[model samples]
Structures are given as structure tokens and as C-alpha cells.
Target: MSDMLSIEQREQAWVFTLNRPEKMNALAPELVLALTEGIQAAHQQKIPLMIFKGNGKNFCAGFDFSDLDTASEGDLLQRIIQIEIMLDLLATSPSMTIALCHGRNFGAGVDIIAACKHRIAAAGTSFRFPGIKFGLILGTRRFQNIVGTQNALEILSSTRTFDAQEAQKIAFMQEIREPEQWPSLIEQAEQNNAILSDVTRRNLYKVLYCSAESDQNLAALVRSASAPGLKDRIRAYLKPN
Candidate 1:
């Protein structure tokens, strides 16, 4: 209802679409709020699962850098808190949450996938966390949870581009396939409804998110700094002597 997120339920799953494709599905404050509201409402409705993907082209690129220019410190924190809330909801909700990512998924996109119970990318998708070049921050704290510490450091530090194959290999996504496979793939997710029990889900998440919230439970905390500092250091180190 925020005009930023579109929600629809089909069969047994609630589908949340990132609606800002013109901005490459960037996460703005209002959109974050919409996502939070949508997820909470769906859980209340007893929807068995939630699936996230983007409309238009790519799934999600990342946060809108332009929004940062005029946003207040409090507003920034609030938006991020909302995102954390969404991720937690996705992780611990009685329903199984999945990301059906396609096209370019970068920075915050990686963090988004980390929160879902399962993530899959279309073969056309490309995943990267190039926040190091920008002044943006993506998944640093939960980097280990998704890619493990070593690969996390390598990817975050190198800021390299990876495809769905590498993503699957790195454990960032469960499967990678053609866009045409979406129907069958989604059907597969729908079928999972039969095997998933809410009680089991609750217990599984209790163990998954030990510290309370799902993100915290998963320990997927972002690195403390969002502005640029290390980038400067790395640039300085790379500068001509």
C-alpha cells in the first residue's frame, strides 16, 4: 500500500515484490516500511510462506544512495531498523521465506538473501557487494553466515562480480536456473507447504536465531560503519608511492 511494495498471495504463499525497479529495486525508507508492514500482515494472515522478488528487471540492486544525502541520521537508522525487522520476520515467521532473485543483485541484495530461509537466482542474475567502492555498506556482520568468513572477506574486500553459478557454489543461493523455470520452481516451493510444519519451523528458527530476532539470531549484523573509511584506506594503500 506504500506504492513501494506490492503484495499478493497465491495458493499457499505470500509474494512480496520490490516495486522500485526504475531505481533498480533500491530500498528507500518508505519501501522498507512497506516491506515491514507487508510481512507482518502476511504472518498475521497465516500465510504459509513468503516469497520475495523484484518487478521489472533486476531483483534488487541495493539502497538508494541519493536518499542518504538529505536523510536525517535518525531517519537512516529507522530505515535500516525496518530492514532488519523485515529480515528477522522473514527468518522467523512461521512461513518459510525465500528469495526468487533474478538479474542484478548487489550490496543490500546480498543481505536480503541472507535473511531468507532459501534463495535462488535465475541464470541471468549477477551478485556482487561493491559497497566498498561506493560509500555504502551491505552485509559485513552476517557475511560469514551466508558466505562464511573467508569467502565473505574475499568477496567484500575484493568487491568482485559473481554469477549465479559462483553464487550457488559459494552458498549464497541454493539453485540457479533459467527464467523459464520460474513456474516449476515456484510450484516446487508451493509443494514444500505440505512438508513444513509450523511447530517445526518455530523450533528450527528458535535455534536459527538464538539471540531473539532472526538477523541477530543468525548473527548477520552489518559492519558498524556505513560511510566510507576503509575505502579511503584501501585507496591510499593502492595509491602511487
Candidate 2:
């Protein structure tokens, strides 16, 4: 396991903790690879439940854009690809994926939680889809699949931050719990995993992902990512006037 993440195999679940509290658990290349590897390992072992949580005040503040000004276009593209891979992995893994969200879940952080099969969050948690604000198209279809298409459009089209309660109403956050109640809720979920079969779970995801328009959706994302002035727009957003 990489230093960026803590991986633990428990009796009822496999836990993956993002260990970058200092960065508000921002997504980094190493951290992303570590997460991907951890999830892949869980799938290989046929782990029934996988829990993702961040060891910090916030679940995640989104991608580590600290180096955006110096990063080349190739570097930016690679980062986006890695994020896509992780989101896809989480979505399609045979293991039942859960995201325990809190605080700042913005940009790609929103995508991560959206990709999970289950989402639970503490009160006061905040979420935003800032890709549109930065001229990027990311996790649009997945977000649409999680919430309805109209809700997804509403959230993505505006960069305003939404609270956990609002997220629950929209079905983006399935459950909202107090900090103290999180443990019991997670335990309950893990204990209930015994009733679910790995094959059934995997096939369910397969059917959900392999849609007739899957290729078309991906093509749209690719086209948007390659759109002219995208780099400049992202840079401008990150570095504001």
C-alpha cells in the first residue's frame, strides 16, 4: 500500500482510507494509483464490502491542482485519465463500494462518491461540481446516473456548494448521519453484506455500465476534454484574475 492511503482488511469489510489530511485529502497521482490498486485487490479477493473514507476534516477537496500552473498539457491529461480509471474501477468493481463523505467534497471528489454504490455523509458536509466552472467535462454521466439527468444538469451547470442535507434530497448522498452514528451505520452495512453474493453484485454493475450508449457517452467526454482553450480555461480558473 502506498503512503498516500491506508489499506486494511477487516473481518466484515476492506477499508481504504485516504491519508492526506494535510491536503484535505486532495487527489494526487500516487494516491490515485494506490486507491486503484487497493480496489483492484479487493475485487480479486472477492471482498464483499469496501469502505472509502478520508482521515481528515474533509473527505476530499478534489484534485491536487497545486501544480497546475507548471504542469504540461500531457501531465494534465494523464491526471484526468487516472481519475477516470479510478472512477470506472470503483463503479464496476464486484465489491460493494461505500463512500463516507464529510466536509469538502468538490470537483472530482463529488465524482468519487457518485461512483460508489452506497454513499453516506455526515451533516455539514459540502459538495460541488466545479468542472463546468473550470471548463472541464468529468463524471457527467455517472452523476446523471446517480441523481436524475435534470438534477445533474442543475448541479453541474452551477458551481454553487450544496450541503449534505440538499445532497440527500437529490439522492446524491443516500444517507446523512451524525458523526457518532457513522460507525454503527457502517457496521450495519458490513454485517448485511453476508446476504449478498459477489457474482450477483458484479453482474449488476456490468448491466448498469454496459449500456447501449456507453461508447457514445465516453466519446462525448473525450471530445469535451480535447476542446480548444480547455487548458487555458482550467489554468485561468485555477489562477483567477
Candidate 3:
């Protein structure tokens, strides 16, 4: 119901669309809360498949820094914490999760795609994980688990932008698909979801999900983001020479 996110049910899947195209669907606090609530609802309703997409040019641009000048460091840290919690929930969700990523995605936006079971990106989509540039460790562990330690280091260390092809090569993306091919992808996922009963599927996810390190991941993010001059680091990262 929140304007920041549009939710719709199609057959057995629930689609949650990020609706802030003007801002590249950045994860503003309100939008993050809306998405968290929507994910929770999908879990409660036992939806078999949960799909995430965005409207307009890009999937998501990452954390909203529009109000950085006015926000204290503590406020920014809390926002990052909330985003991590939401991502943990999505990553460990019982239902099958899919992300349809396109255009340019950065920071926590890339984290969202990383959390999903099925990560499909448009042909020319690109991603950058620049949280480290600001001394933030958000999603590093999960990303490493997805793309391996060496690849993660190379990508995150440089904070460089990589295209969808490179993403698939690194195993960060499961497939490179055009937007028009997405409907069939959804249908395939729906069919796959129907293969298992709700309880069985939930059990399977519980068995397969490696969340034992989630707490540690959160702690690391907190420690890094809580370091002194958090705002200064962010500002420097934003306005590079």
C-alpha cells in the first residue's frame, strides 16, 4: 500500500516493484520499510515465489543519500542497519526469491540482487559495490559467498563497475536476460515453485540457507559503519577529487 513500492500477486508469486524511478529507486528509509513489510507479508501468506523488480531506467541506485547533509552519523548508521536486517530476512526467506536487475545498480542495490536465489540481469546492466569506499562493510560476507573470495576482493577492492556478462562469469548473476524475457522467467519460477509443498519448500530453504554467519556479518557492518568520521568518509567518497 505504500507509494514507494507497488505489490501485486500473479498466480503463486508476489511481485514487489521498487517505484522510485526518478531517484533510481534508491533505498530511502520509507522505501526500505515498505519493502521489509511486503517481504514479511509474503512470508506470512506462504507465497511460493517472491519477485523483486524496479520501474523505469534502473532497478535501484542503492542507499538514498539525498538528505546526507541533514542526517547525523547515527541516523545514517541506523538506516544501514535496517537495510542489513531486511536483507538478511530476504536472504533467508522460505519462499523462492528472484531479482530482475537492469541498468545501473550500486551499493546496497547490488546487495539486494545478491540476496536473491535467482539473480537475472538485463543484457547491459552494470553493478558497483562502493560501500567499502565509505568504510562500510555492508553485504560483504554474503557477496563473497556468492562470488567467491578472490572475485569479491577484486571487485570490492577496486569499487569498480562491472557489466552483467562479467557478473555471470563471476557467478554473481545466474542469468543474463532481456526485460522482455522476464515473463517467461517468472512463469518458469512459478512452475518450479509448485513442485514442492509449502512446508517442504520452507524446510528445504532452511536446510540450504547458510545464515550462521549472519550475526557476524551484521556485527562487522556495525563496527565499520560505527567508526569515527562516518559522515566524513561518506562525503569524501561521494565528492572525490
RMSD values, in order shown: 4.3, 1.8, 0.9
- Candidate 1: residue 74 lDDT (0-100): 53
Ranking by TM-score: 3, 2, 1
Per-residue lDDT over 1-241 for candidate 3, one digit per residue giving the tens place of the 0 to 100 score: 6798999887699999999999999999999999999999998888889999999899999999999999999999999999999999999999899999999999999999989988999999999998898899999988998899999999999999999999999999989999999999999999988989988998888988877978998999999999999999989989958
List model 1 lDDT by residue over 1-241, tens digit each. Answer: 7887888878688788899978988888778778888888887877877888898789888766565546665566556556666666665666778888888877776678777878888887887876665444444655567778898888888988888888899898888866678768778888876585877766776777543534443333343433435334435534568
- After superposition, candidate 2 runs with Cα above 4 Å error: 208-217
The backbone clash count of each candidate, in order, is 2, 0, 0
List, residue by residue over 60-96, the lDDT tens digit for candidate 2. 8888888877888778877877887788778767677
Each model's lDDT: 0.72, 0.82, 0.93
Work out the TM-score per prediction.
0.82, 0.92, 0.98
- TM-score: model 3 vs. ground truth: 0.98
TM-score attained by model 1: 0.82
